[model samples]
Target: MFQDPGVGVFQAWDYVVFAALFVISSGIGVFFAIKERTKNTSKEFLVGGKQMTCVPVALSLTASFMSAVTVLGTPSDVYRFGGSFIIFSIAYTMMVTLTAELFLPIFYRSGITSTYEYLELRFSKAVRMAATLIYIVQTILYTGVVVYAPALALNQVTGFNLWGSIFATGIVCTFYCTLGGLKAVVWSDVFQMVVMLMGFFTVLIQGTIKNGGPVAVWKAAQEGSRLNVFDFDPDPLRRHTFWTISIGGTFTWLGIYGVNQSTIQRCISCKSEKQAKLALYLNLLGLLVILVCAVFSGLVMYTFYAKCDPWTAGFVSAPDQIMAYFVMDILGHMPGLPGLFVACAFSGTLSTVAASINALATVTYEDFIKYWFKNLSERAGTWISKGLCIVFGVACTTMAVAASYMGGIVQAALSIHGMCGGPMLGLFSLGILFPWTNWKGAAGGLLAGITLSFWAGIGGFVYPAPASKMMPLHLNTSGCELRNSSDILTTLAPTMAPERPALADSWYSMSYLYYSAVGWLATVIAGLVITFLTGPTRGGDIKPVLIRPVCNLLCFWSEEYRKACWCGVEHDAADMDLSGDYISTDILAMRREEPTEISKKDGKDSGDDLPGHIAEDRSYTNAGFTKDTDL
Candidate 1:
């Protein structure tokens, strides 16, 4: 029973919700930008002075990763297919473990601001440059996808112009990110995450109440076979098989959160390594909770429209617009709900793009610019960094126009992530796990990785295939126009049944779920094999804990892991450099000596060492300015 949709258009209350968000976000940026204007250093501008708390940082991580693609796309997946997407919990679990146990200790112990800077230390500058460029491209594409997804949905719901929405979002996101830098981005994320949660919860709860309840929603979804989650099929060609999704998701997440700059930037900003770990763990929990809400919303959506489904009944244009249609269908008459829904969707968009812009600017400045512009002043550098943020933000907005041509929001976004993520992650993996993978090997592997990744990612899009429709849980023709068979919901085919071409490559039809893993393996295998062919660099600049193998497996343990992986690097109490969870009298002694060292150097302690997790604050010093710069 899809009613007149114009009734759900933006009311004054709706405009107020969006207006308040812009005012608050820009205000925070201005406040922070002005407050830290005195610092005038890339460190402070990029990394929040490295004194962030666990909670805000955790919430920021939550907000940064949950793009509008997830906000809108996940529910669409659930409503269309079933509960299989919930398996992402498995992926997140693996991601949390891999990130915390392996990747976190590596990056945190290195005391890095940019994740790829580790590449330069571990391999060569070429490898670092390669990774940075890949990341920049990926973030640019992803920011567009993030912006485009919700803008499209909102346009469908409220009749707002899509291009206008995109540009407006770009302008607002660029303004705050350019002005406030990381602190502004994090604080705004904390606030927007609250809005996102409230909006999602409201929709799910309201939709559930209107459609009967949770139990009814569940029963309705299950009856249609849309509730199937555990498909252990080993077929590589199938779309959502368990092996493909789980391992692929794990690798995908590892690529995104483990080695990527955006997540690592947040992790490093924490007060200490332990606090960073806390943020990562809390982010995992937050993702689990949010994903549950999204899946439930999908169930309610399916049940509500099981019989007189709007899409089948000619009430909607595209599958991606289904959630927006549901918003109007159930919550339209409510004065502020429709606007809140739009606000909620765009909140995800803004948080994601804002974080990417800030982080991208940071990486560009640190990894790409700092060494090149040796004589750049702190003031000049700050402005340039801000300029980069604005430039990337605008570029991202421009790309959103192209992303509208992609299929579904979630898949399109994930496809972009995997294409770059797999190769980037592979480069890092080769650095840590394989000592012989020198710059030659890394460069070769990177190229091969990207080639194969793009092939796997884009090939399916190019090859036209007929979709195999699946039977829905329920369908009714009672309220449908019944003008044609295509408008019938239950009669729609599943995604697996694509129309075959004369030369349809089953290989190209490999599931997107397997993309990250496939691309990762492609790069690593190519790099490893090519490493030996290139006469292997032998021994590496990587830290011991980075390549420290799993010593003592199944009671067959030993202390010889030192000679196992990267060679000559042994695990000692000194390995605490790799893990902050360790404490000792010597570490305590070193900590006690730090302030004394600072006091003696600055004479009267000019307060260079600000408290929490204090280290030598590398400020304008890197840009040819001495530590004793005149204020």
Candidate 2:
């Protein structure tokens, strides 16, 4: 083992940068909660009153997926493997297009509070509850991973105990998410995004200057085969292939951004369905730009440490610590640089955790508690929501404390996401894409999809696979001879990975990147098969949910079908029924008659009976939790 000199310690001002973030975030939370207390309803607390513009939602979306996992894992992955992973941008592109085209209209038009509420309208309450349960499980696990990623990294370089960092992150995020709800979360996320971008420039500019420039970094990465971005091989065992990443990433994001409560809430919160679509589309560009810079930073790290492999030389405990190591190496001399970078990492952590806490609370209140305790007062519901945020915050912190027991946070996070995301995405797709898919079909497909997903995920991730082991790209450690190797090695014994199993050469070695796509296909295929086998529902039964084209595809067969479809939406008067008003089920489980029709038929101007804005103007008030919507 070899070692490099450490970057001594943080100055007093460094602490100031971190402290300011806490104060501002806490104050924002308190300010919003109290300010909105008068006008605040369950709707306001959850979705920011649905008056949001595109930029904030877009930025929040960017912040969600820009977790510490990306900040640390991208650099480590590039260092260990190649930059081919950057092809995931293609996935982001697909997510934007597909979401804008198929998902946004249905979800936005429905005007429901929770994403799972769409399940009840399309299928059954059972499906809604089931999907909600899956989402809860996925997000809770995801929050733990998100919280743990930065805490672990900060611990390695700054000597801040992981436990302390985890607890601190949870407390601050919970406090604000509990107070201001969505507004506070969104504004805090905006602040964090600025800090993240600042950290990006600091590392890139400073690291590039120290490494002799961009050209030098490129040359170093090229020599080590770290710049390979196009691997066309179809082998599932060979991870990071182009098809697997792009296709797999597409489904993974669709599972997350397309159907998850966190991202959907942002879309729902937009001023209009069109605005949500625009914001979601714009989110793609932001993610691409950030990731491109993040990937390059990895190559730059290789440039500076080309002659000193940190993992092999033993300056760090794991490969994930490389980013913090490089930050200290290049920017350590600048008094606040280290703190800024740590802040950047925590920005990802705190924004994501806060977003998750808020979304979890929102869903719990809207989906589960709201239905059972129908008569509960608004104040009591809000308090319960705040309490839920605190509970989830603590749960995430606890998971962080135990996160060390899990393996690589990067792959672990992706796999956990895929394992749950796939099935959930499938359930939503069934409701959106195929109208004939009944509750039975959705339930069966979801169960089977989840089972297959877990089996493949566990076999691929948890179990051993020897032949599939990724050999580290050759390292140039000649420049690392100045320090005594034994001393550093003694403090942290370099992890010698365990031996692989014979199954590594079999189907069990399938890469986790493609798990998202796998889960989605299993669900759709299984859903379609089951729907046909068990007597299918009438085509009329589905017009309320199916995409227009799919519904239109059935028009040639029957006149009744054409008349029955086009379930909602305000179309031209030419298509209006003889009765003189639109009949819509958009307010699922809430209203049976359109307000205009109800008022006219009842012979009274009684529209106030329902919360009218609940239809389109309500959505998630907080930031993009993991996928980055600000509060």
Candidate 3:
């Protein structure tokens, strides 16, 4: 009963449903903008006045990174690479737990806006600015892919102009994000999350019914060799092995959930640290829910195309388009259902793009612009934040147009993360975990890590693995009704092979999944070497609050030994003063110490012992600055 779609497939009701997504998203932004019009300071604009509850923040956290890449690419990946891609679920669990235990505590205690500000506190201004630039580049490139992926799919199925879709999605996202700030972004994310899930479920339920049932789908996958989940081969060159995905994938996602500013901004916006932790754990559950839906959707696609394989039949030009084609072919008769799927992809686009744009604006204002204009007004800063959102939104939308020429949506996005993330993750890890690493080490390590990642990632792109090495699991076009005998043979024929290169010469042949791991290791190793050569930072020079102890695993050691192992910095009882959840005891003690004690301890005037920046910025008593001077 299925027929190929030669033109646009969306019905009148389908357009209505699709249009409603933007309307609702824009409305949420307007509501928040109006509500907070009286007091839309920089703090309120950036972090919702730090009074947000856990639920919206949690949903926003999950929705921030769960863009069209996951919705469209995950299914396409599983269908082509087998169910081994599901191993990423393990990676997901690892990243969330590690982030919760190790990273969140320090972030909540600091109460900072820009995540990169911690870089300055731990290292120096140069390192902080370097990290900020890297984040900006990584986010812009990734947002491009996020916007482009859904637009490409829409173009394929509905004959929508690709650029029009990109601008429409981008403009709507920019409108809401610029109008309402973080509150609008978070609430819109919550609303969009619902729409996205509904769309995914519509495709899954309808597609499963058309394919018979779960058992039949599984059987089809098994026959097609698409159920290869437990591939334990230890070869690094093999594409989708369990170790590569689980281990390398852990570092890849850790770069996102652990230290990336997009999720960090949402997490720290909550009213308290406890609320922030709750949001992270809840985000884990949301991630697993979306993961299951995406993986199952891939399986359903495999069931329908088990014998025909849409790509080889020339029904679709790319693997990414297969999901869109399946939606139109299967759900086309149902009118608004196909529109729901489109809405799903667009919801993902809006949430992710909006989050990235907001976070970018935050870092630009807090890290770069604020220092330049010390006398900038609160009202001016708020307007600047909105203006920055518009600027980033337009820039990202333009990049989306450029991202169209790239290959395989999932791989491209993850590779970008791995290449940039590994270095950024390495920089943060060096600063937080090892107190001995000085500014030289931090700067050198970041540079080296990025160099290696790009060399490998770019090399891999230029000289891709040979067809024999990178070939997909057996896909057949034997059942395609439109294909004649000759056509089928041509579709299935093997092309002439290029001469095989030597293993030593083919470093780029390493699985793309391991790019993050490679970059991370390069950074750590290079960093330690540079630190030792440049004379490691003394324990006295580092702050205890900035260092996270890695000695939790030393249960067999004595308490004193564990304490000594942690940054080797001595902490007196008076070092930490906790007011509410934000800890700044040591900082306050320095400022409030008796004049005689200050003279005795540092041989300097009272308050002169504090760092110049800290003393100059009087509002920096709590974490970095007080409410009166946060901007």
Give candidate 2 regions above 4 Å deviation.
Answer: 1-3, 467-471, 482-504, 543-631
User: Which residue segments of model 1 deviate by more than 4 Å?
Assistant: 1-7, 464-466, 469-478, 482-503, 540-556, 561-566, 570-631
User: Cα lDDT of model 2 overall?
Assistant: 0.76
Ten residues in sequence with the least summed lDDT for candidate 2: 622-631
Q: Which candidate's TM-score is highest?
A: 3
Q: Tens digit of lDDT per residue, candidate 2, span 178-217?
A: 8898888887888887888888888889889998988888
Global lDDT of each candidate: 0.76, 0.76, 0.82
Clashes of each: 15, 32, 3
Candidate 1 lDDT at 531 equals: 82
List candidate 3 segments past 4 Å from native: 1-8, 483-505, 573-631
lDDT of 1 by residue, 310-396 (tens): 666667766788898888777778878777777888888889999999889989998878768866777898899989998898899
Worst 10 residues of 3 by lDDT: 611-620
TM-score-superior candidate, 1 or 3: 3
What is the Cα-based lDDT of residue 103 in candidate 2? 79
CA RMSD of all predictions? 6.1, 5.5, 4.3
